[model samples]
Target chain A: MNQTKFSSWIFDSFKVSPEGLGLYRIFCGLFLLFFLLPSAGIYPFISSLPHTFFQPPPGPMALFDGFPSHSVLLLLHTMLILSICSMTLGWNTKKSSILTGVLLLAIKGFVYSVGKINHDFLIIIVPVLMAFSGWGEVYSVDAFLKRNMQKVEGWVLTLLALFIGFMFFTAGFSKLIGGWLNVESQAALGHVFKQYYVVERQDFLAGFVVNINSPFFWECVDYLTVIFEVGFLLAIFHPRSTRIFLCFALLFHFSLMMVLNISFLPNFLAYAAFLNWTWVDHFIKQKAANTEVKSVKHKWLAPVVIALALVGGWAIIHLIGNDAVLQADWGLAGFIVISGSLPIAIYHLFDQLKRWILERLK
Target chain B: MKKNTVKKIFIFFLIFLPLQYAAVGIIGLEKSEPWPAFILPAFQNVDATPEDVLVKEPVLSIVDSTGVIADAVPSGKLFMGIHESQIQGFFRAHFRDSTRWKGKNAEARSWLANRVNQLYPTADPQSVNVRWINRYYDLSSARRRIDSTRVINEFSISLRDESN
Candidate 1:
């Protein structure tokens, strides 16, 4: 194909409907907000500490010589939460999304200033990009008020897919280069596992993997993990391949949650942004029709259920009150696994129940 | 933000992408290179390395003006919901590196001064000091006892300058 034709094809493929971007925006917002809820108490915690304890990361370090006053930190955190809520609710969404992104970056810098960076950094990038796109053009209050139905450039979703795909691919490949693929010793996974278990001595779930009877089996699985991650890029080539890769990725993250006690739900949700959810929508509609239930009645059902589950889980954890129970090897592992799987399981159950009710009506 | 340009750039980014992290992994293996945040190398062999050279256990204690010693409160208990790693990392950042030890100690001194002031609002302590205990534990041992003698580092702050 000629260059002009190729460019046109690429442009056309990257153009996504307003609904697609809006759905992606919603997923990103929900994942970030939910993950951040538990950390809301951090403001008061920081306030009680000495100002010297606040070692702002490089960017913010340049901006301020000392820690901001307690009132300012509290104000910033409150605004962060409020903006996240506004972004998710699709009210003044574009600005709110941008504000949320900025707040996430600022909070991350503040938290990491003292010398620890975490995996949640990837979560904000997609939302920041969404702010600049046409995501708020549909399935949003702005869209509802304006009656806008314009198609946005599809690059936004594609970019999100690439970030998720490349992130895992990079993680896996990084291990490979560090000699994870070296079969002679198969010590890479053992050492990585030992880092948290032995060095950090903070084991909640991975201790089981550390104590596994068959070392060779886990080593082989580690190699397979690298292969799966490196091979993830194939998903971007086609929808079917992307779906297949996403399934494997979800399983991989679920397994990681069990063994490593780490949950990558934000990455999983970002992966969903790449999928054409028309099929899921059709399924919901068909079920709603059979049951003679207005689908709009259930539109807000998923988010409401998720919020309730999260609040209930937090309350239970607080009531338990034993730090040992919350941080024990088995206890922490179980909590992560249940928390990670529960929402997805509940959503599926709700969908199936809706379908079952419609079938009975038929 | 032109649609055509964005599509082309993304295509370029995905081109030969397997080598992108592969290169980063190679650079990171040496442990001295400045790595871009969020990038990881392919093989990070953590266990095979000798733990004696890599790990140091930090024990913190507070010493009052009269030299009375008391166990420093754990940051996790104080913060009341932070991950264990965050609490550890916060202190580790202060204790681990020798070059920055003084600066970190000065900061600790300021914190201890403020803490003492808060605890004794009626009469602040004349001096408050923080003592850092560094001990190395050999993982290969069955008991995991301290491999070396405990090394003590101390920093003090005076209440006379606390108002400043």
Candidate 2:
């Protein structure tokens, strides 16, 4: 293709359904909520550590000079949890998503301030991009509320894919620079496994595989890693190529998790952004074709009721001051009931209001 | 936004991607400026002969003044059922900087002491020690026989303030 045609093709390719971004947003938010949020419970212990222990990285992260106090940590955690919920449900998504990203970065900064920085940057960047884009326009509470067909520019998804691709390319380039391809130097794949063995974290299977000590096998793995990572950028424009890389990436991550016990769940979920979802979008449209009417009327009632019920229950318990209720585990029950249903209720209510508004406007 | 404008922005960002890697890989700008999110592209696969393998792992022990070891178990395993990488990360940081080792060791000693006190509060405070029983293979031999294990780098920490 000529330059003009190529440029136009690239621009045209960037157009994607907002539903795709919504899917990415919801999955990422859920991953954060389920997998990452619980880890914040350690904030109390982390907060107790002396300030000198935190060797904060330079730039924006440097703001975290010392760990936050327990109360501040708790507050940040609360905000993060709330933000995650809103972003997931697509309630006030633009603001909520931005909040989620900022809070995520803040939390990560505090978490990694001690010494090493974890490679979970994608989880933060993607959401921030979504916040600015039209991600909330479909497959979300925002979409349900707006009651309008919204088409997001494809650039948003393209940028996210490119970010991941760039990351892999850099990773491969970095390995090349570090001489990972040179097997004779003993500083390649074989050496990596040996080091892991020395560190004594090797799983039975990993240990067995590394024990073979076959130079040929080691060389293949070493070269494969570099080639796959460096070549990942090619998958960005080609859907078929993306599937292959996606499978390879998933396998690589799973193997890493199995052998090394390193969990990058957020990054794993972020990979879903690369999917075109043309079929999934069609299926969603078909499914929603029927319910588009009733969904409008009932959106506001459920959330209002759920919120009041939770508050009233809490108030009644406080007024009663019954130790029996406490002993009966009512607190835990209330927590489970509220935390479990609040997101769904909020989403329902937001959608209902959107449809109601749209009806009135029509 | 105009289509042309969006295209221009896309192209600019596309260019920005490689320029970033170049900054990190070639210009060392990322290292000097140290953008918090920008990871310097460096891969490490350290090679070592079988002789470098530690068959017998080291232990960091807390022994009381009366010579009784503290009740604290040496669990270098990962926390919350995650893989060993997390625990390895804790140790890797200590090993990464020789200059900071002493300070880091002291911090670890204090943390361990506090943990032991919580476990066995009645036990009197004591000195902490890191002992390594090292054994490596004699790979040069056809059989690759394991060498006799010997104690190596058995360092002891005596806290000036036992309370710390």
Candidate 3:
């Protein structure tokens, strides 16, 4: 594919609707404000645990007694809240998005070193992409003031799609390391399940599993977890693949919720919103338009698109494997890779499904 | 220049405001010498004592080595019921009816009082009055200097045996 055609394809894939941008800004702004209010002691709420499962060894109880009283922490949180609010309101939206992103990175760095870091840290990518995508063009204070704003192009949406996919891809690759691949690693599963049961006593599914007393059931769970996590990148690259994978991801999370009684599955579901719903719609529309056009000469574009998708998918998976933090948890790292790539997978899957359905109807 | 002016104003207020409040709070704290809440009660010196005394044929004449009458108990065939009621009330007022103390009869309170008197024979029982002291002063500072040469002035009167 020529540079012009490739560039155009990339640009066409990312364009987003005004409504999508508005939704993004609103949710991101609200999330920041919600966390900031509690952090500042303005509204005392049940504090979320800062410790990640992968945190380094136990330290002094006094050190982990509560949130830090440092002035810098307060300043950073205040800045983040203001920036996100401004971005949502569309007042100097681009600058606010950039500021929010930078402040988030700074705060994450400070908190991650002391507290346990979660996969939610990947949400930072949204603001970073929004800063460049000119997402403030719609549903912003700026758009209201200007009265006339150009619609966002496809490239912006594509960037968001890619970012989401990369997140899941990285997570999947991270889990492929160490004893995670072994079918006999029932001990690790037992440990995680026990922790889940203790934290959430209503594990009806887990109780059944425990009563059955079959080692084979545990082995099946162990292999299925690794496969679903590692297969995320493949499942997300095509529409049919993604539909299958989405079911798998959903089932994976649901089973964990039922058996392990973990609450993080809801958070994962929320992040899946970055998938390329627009691309799917575009593919469907384009395929319908192509049916009537005589002498359609864009057959070569299909191969190029496939190759680009593969390369992009492979690159995301590679990045996940290389990430030092994800690699630390050999058993769970594959899930991290799959999680990183989930956004991209969803977007591509939508695009392929849209195109296939449109062609069949024509 | 306008931006610089706004920045300067912000920096000035930010640096000065917290310091001003902090300085005032620290000064107030230092002036108060505020003690921890739990430690305040230890400084209160509340004396425990009672007024009445009973006289009878001395069963045990407890005295210090200098031969001063510190304490004494009367011998038998007395109104044991009335004597016990008074002694039990005295013990209850001082010790709050603790299970550790055996308030069996009049003999128990007398036994304990006699033992205390023997140890400090010169301590005039009449002189031992309950006095409320100022709480602000430390308990260690209120210790009395015992002058061994000085004699106690209070004396016990012997009541005639009514049964005889």
Best by DockQ: 2
Please list the C-alpha lDDT of all candidates, in the order they appear: 0.56, 0.58, 0.41
**Model 3 interface DockQ:** 0.01
Cα-based RMSD of the predictions, in order?
A: 7.4, 11.3, 28.4
lDDT of 1 by residue, B43-85 (tens): 3553332333123335444445556444554545433545554
CAPRI-style grade of the A/B interface in model 2: acceptable
Model 3: per-residue lDDT, tens digit, A1-362? 45555455455433466555554555455544532222343111102222221112122222343434456567777788888778767788777877876777655444433222234433465566566555566556787798435445445444343333444544444344435445444533443433332222233365555343444665565566656665665454343454556545655554554455432422332344454434543464467467876444353233234334434544565565532332112112334434445555556557767988999999
* Tens digit per residue, CA lDDT, model 3, B54-138: 1111123433334535332331112121121123222223323233123223333444344445444656432211111111111
lDDT score of residue A76 within candidate 1: 78
Give the distance in Å from residue A20's predicted Cα in candidate 3 to where it truly belongs.
2.7
> Candidate 2 residues B35-59, lDDT tens each?
4443423454444343333344455
TM-score (C-alpha, index-matched) for candidate 2: 0.72
What TM-score would every model get versus the actual structure? 0.71, 0.72, 0.44
For model 2, name the residue pairs that clash: A14-A154, A15-A154, A145-A354, A299-A349, A299-A352
Select the stronger candidate by lDDT from 1 and 3. Answer: 1
Residue A127 of model 1, lDDT score:
68
lDDT of model number 3: 0.41
Model 1 CAPRI rating: acceptable
Q: Quality of candidate 3's docking, in CAPRI categories?
A: incorrect
| Candidate 2 RMSD to the correct structure | 11.3
